[model samples]
Every structure is written in C-alpha cells, then in structure tokens.
Target: MDEDTPRLLADTNPLPETIDARLAQQLTFLIEIDRLKTVLRQSPLAAADRRENDAEHSWHLGLMVAILAEYADENVDIGHTIELVLIHDLVEIYAGDTPLYDAGKGLDQREREAAAAGTLFGLLPADQAARFRALWDEFEARQTPEARFAKAVDRLQPLLLNWMARGGTWRTPGVTADDIRARKAVIGDASAALWAAGQELIDEGERRGWSRPGSASIT
Candidate 1:
C-alpha cells in the first residue's frame, strides 16, 4: 500500500452503525402515530355530547373491517383494506375533521389532506412510506375496488354511531337525511351491499324518531 493511502485512511472516520433497511421500515409502522388523538372541535359521537378523537374513529373503522368484511364487494382484501382504514384518518391528525354540513370548507380539503398525508406517511421509511401513501391516495381517489370498499367502511362508521347512539354527535348538528345520503353515495361504487346497509340505518333512524324523514335530527 502507498504511504498516501495510509494517510487517507487515517483522515477518514468510521461510518455510523447502519440499520437494517427492512427492519427500519417495519419499525416505522410500529412507531406510535402522534398528533392522532385530538378530538375534533366540532364533530361529535353518535350518542354523546363530546366529540370522538381521531384514534377512536380509526380504531372503530378497523373493527368494522373485521366484522363487516363479508359485506364487502369483489372478495376484498381485508388486511390491506384495514391498513388503509387505519391510516385514512391519520391526515385528520393534522388537517382536522371537516363535517359534511360545513359547506364550502372542502375548497382546500384536498390540498390540506395531501400535505398532511406527506408529513404523516413520511414518518415511515422509504418503501413503507410509499406503501402507506399509496393506500391513502387510493382512498382519496376512490378508484380501486379495495379503496372503494375502504371508503364505504369509512362512511358507514359515523352513520352507525349516529344511528345507534340515538342522536349522538350527529344529532346536535342537525344533519339532514339528504346530507348523509349524498356523502355516503360514494360507497355505492364499492359495495351496493354496504350502501343498502346505510340506507337501512337511515330508515331505522327515521322510524325510531332519532331523526326526521328528511330534515336533520336536531331540528
């Protein structure tokens, strides 16, 4: 070896310990998702006056996936769909929830959600980041069968809560039947079965006097 080579080696420092890329990626998913437990300032639970936290919402949807998988159309991939459901609400950790009756608020909804998606999903390592973002994007785009079904499950949650809680959080806002139906129609593309289930809930709400036939429950 040349004397210059020895000098160059002396000048260099040892590289920092490298982490296993795969393990790093896996651990990212295990990382405690932060800023994800804030209760929506305006949104409420079905039967209660208090607003539910994003973590509660996400967990509720995850349970729906386990219990309602058979209701999904096209032999849905339950595991991936559950992952999608779990992360879908993560953006709310940053952007906050926009209620359906809050007209004109959606103007910046896409931009805010996209930014939140980047920040939250980027917490994971490269490949896992890509995977998480793809799941979120698919739900936003409402394009794939899995995404469609995930979206359906997403919509079903608030409705079930509002209906069962007998004027839960949704009752206070005076949300209307039309508003609920329109927001939930996106689910029809994924599963007519789930949509039918939603319709049944609406009918039951009206029949039980939880809500009016057409008007919001509060009014």
Candidate 2:
C-alpha cells in the first residue's frame, strides 16, 4: 500500500447466497400479487357480479383498517394487520375459496389450504418465504390481536355485501344464517363490537324477511 494513497479494503465477507434467494422470493410475491388480479370468485353470498379476487380483497381490507382502526378494541399496528389480511387469502389461488357452508365437495379444506400455503408461499426466496409463511400462519391461527383483527375484517366484508345485496347471493345452495354465524363467530373474539354489529345485521335481516330468523341456532 502506497503511503499517500487511499487504502482499498474489500468486503471480503459479502452477504450470503440467502440474500439473493430472499430477493427472488420477494419478487415472486410481487408476481403472485399481480397474478391474483385475474382470478375472480364469488363471495359466500354468491353475488351475481362475482366477488372481487384475492388482491382486491386485500386492498379493500387495508382500506378497512385505515377507516376502522378507531373501532379496534385495543391499540393495533394497522400496517401489520393490513399485511396479514393481504396475504391471508392468497392460498385460495391454488386451493380455491371454499364457501364455509359448502365444505362438502372439497378434500378437507384445512388440509388443502395448508398444502397450498406451502407451495404458494414457498415460491419466495427462503428467508422471505419463511417470513411470509409465518405471517400467513399467524393469520390462520387468529391467536394474536393483529391476526384476530385481520380475521374480523375478513368476515365483515361478506356480511356487508350480503346485507347490501338485499338477501342476494347468500341464498345459494342451502346456505343459512347458522352457517354464516358459525363460520364467522371467531370475529366476536377479535372485535366484539364488530361482531355485535354483525349480529344486529343478522337480526335485522330476519326481521325484514331478508334471511331466515333464528337460524343461528344449532338445531
């Protein structure tokens, strides 16, 4: 090394291959996000217009958080919850969205979704893939408050659609209020206020002849 020259040092220990792998994984997420824009599915209510696909669902829920964060029972990181909601339904791309009431035809939806998650999220680079998989798992478990809030928003969307559609698509293939309530009661734990509003919608539906009254019963 020359005395008056600037010394050149090397980054001898560069970031490992995992760094590139993780970047690739994140790219896959971006690609999958774009791809989901094309796959449309019906809501639980079976609306004729065809419910928005997974990407739209995610975007809508993100907006929901922005609009409804004040309604959350406890302080929540809206950004994290929004991330959970956005990714939560991606498994449906491979497994298909199984309506809660029509679980009959599928080969065990839970098992199928688990498999789908493995493959879909696995497309990411290893580290990024693992991070997203954890997020997806957290959302599915509904254990943490953020996950619970995300799940509540998930259930709330369909109910609002059903109510607005004037008893529209929910009448499909023998779906009843019992089925809807059973599928959505987890929301009660997430946000009791939201769940109460849902119950009121159910009650109002029954009173207005929009849905079957007292159908939330187990009988």
> Which candidate number has the best TM-score?
2
Cα-based lDDT for every prediction: 0.70, 0.72
lDDT of 2 by residue, 70-179 (tens): 77777889999989988888887776777655557454888877877887777677777788889999998877888889888888887787787766545665666666
Candidate 1, residue 185: how far the Cα is off, in Å: 2.1
lDDT of 2: 0.72
Show the colliding residue pairs in model 2: 25-124, 25-125, 45-169
- Report lDDT (Cα) of residue 139, candidate 2: 91
Q: Tell me how far the alpha carbon of residue 162 in candidate 1 is from the true structure, in angstroms, after superposition.
A: 0.2
Which regions in candidate 1 have their CA more than 4 angstroms from the true location? 1-32, 41-49, 169-174, 212-219
Please, what are the lDDT tens digits per residue for candidate 1 over residues 57-93? 8888888888888877777888888888998888776
lDDT of 2 at 54: 70
- The positional error of residue 65 in candidate 1, measured at the CA in angstroms, is 1.2
